[model samples]
Target: MSLRLNCDLGESFGSWKMGLDEAVMPHIDQANIACGFHAGDPLVMQKTLTLAKQNNVTVGAHPGYPDLVGFGRRSIKASAAEIKAMLQYQIAAMDGMAASQGLTLEYVKPHGAMYNDMMANAEVRSAIMQGIAEYHRPLVLMLQSTPQAEEHLAEAEQAGISLWFEIFADRCYDDDGKLLARTKPGAVHSKEKMLAQVKQLQEQGTVTTVSGHTLNLRADTLCVHGDNMDGVNAIQEIRELIS
Candidate 1:
């Protein structure tokens, strides 16, 4: 499949605000919207859905652990059953809200620590896959594209769910095909480097890792973040490049 651009949105709380969703929504093809577990409320989600619909962007559920203070970046320990329940709860919430707006969630992409844990822990990954499979309607599961693409695909097949392998356009990857920790230096790329990476992915279908290794990633979609003005501007540039 051709690579598509997606962004996380609807992260604003009642009084506080987060992300330049209004500015970034136009540039993206898919919107991974927060489902209130981490950073969004019903009203904010409704507004985001309306914005996405206005832009003709596809919607995906962005579910995370209930960690508002840490923005869902902090890991939470829970059983596989608990993880499955959490996934379903969030998906149901988003699905109902989207239905209200005459919209439908096209996929599920876990946020923050839940995302990382799903990538690293087999148990967590299985639970998430199972949850998606058991949902009332079919929904694709969007996750990082790693060297273990075949393995992940097999797991998805076993769970009876489709997969969309995603790549980060502005983040550094380790040799293991995992994103570098945010605390680490150079975990995020500057605008020039970010554009360069996207160019390489377009031209060569590979990325250079932090350890100076060439890693081939099967990218179905490219993920962009618009947490600031710079990020919003960068998304516009990236949209042009990818288009």
Candidate 2:
């Protein structure tokens, strides 16, 4: 079983640096880059793409609601049409950015709160897939690999898009197969625990939830956040295990 690693990159805004993208790039298989919505700007995106290219990492667009102030971690009420437009606009911008530099975006991953919303709301998921289909691009959508993923398959197929089931390498899961809130106790795992998680996912194909429930999961890629020094260290550890 090969587990591909993906990390969110190029999240720096104007003067603020969000992650050690350069350090983290070499250890991962995929890069889900911010498309100037939640975070990142034109220059930052270019720099990140250049780094990913140098490292031979597969690139994907990380689109989110336009919430620079909230980092796209806040929920925004919008219709399916609006959500579709938002995704198309962001994905196109990033895809064009990648193309200009002789790189191609092969996938899409919604960032932050939008991701959480999509997991729970069928309408939202459909809207996002609809948007990707409307873009008329052949791109894999990276989404949580919960059982409900089946619910979104029709839309994905209807939209003529593919999907890559994603699992988080460090975050704790709930009994419902959703990620635990960051504020919750035991939501984030320690280094040892994270490694144990990888082992379990490899051997048992299930993750133990924070509520002491075991969740059967399907993972095509594991999300490794590249937001800080700890995250870089985690990525290195995860990369060694997966490779």
TM-scores of all predicted structures: 0.97, 0.95
Candidate 2 regions exceeding 4 Å error are: none
The local distance difference test score of each candidate is 0.93, 0.89
RMSD of 2: 1.3
Could you give candidate 1's per-residue lDDT for residues 34-71 as a string of tens digits?
A: 99999999999999999998999999999999999999
Q: Please report, as a residue range, the 10-residue window in candidate 2 with the lowest summed lDDT.
A: 147-156
The digit string of per-residue lDDT tens for model 2 on 75-157 reads 99999989999898889888999999999899999998899898888889888887877786678889988867776676688
Q: What is the lDDT, from 0 to 100, of the residue 40 in candidate 1?
A: 97
After TM-score superposition, what is the CA distance of residue 196 in candidate 1 from its true location, in Å? 0.4
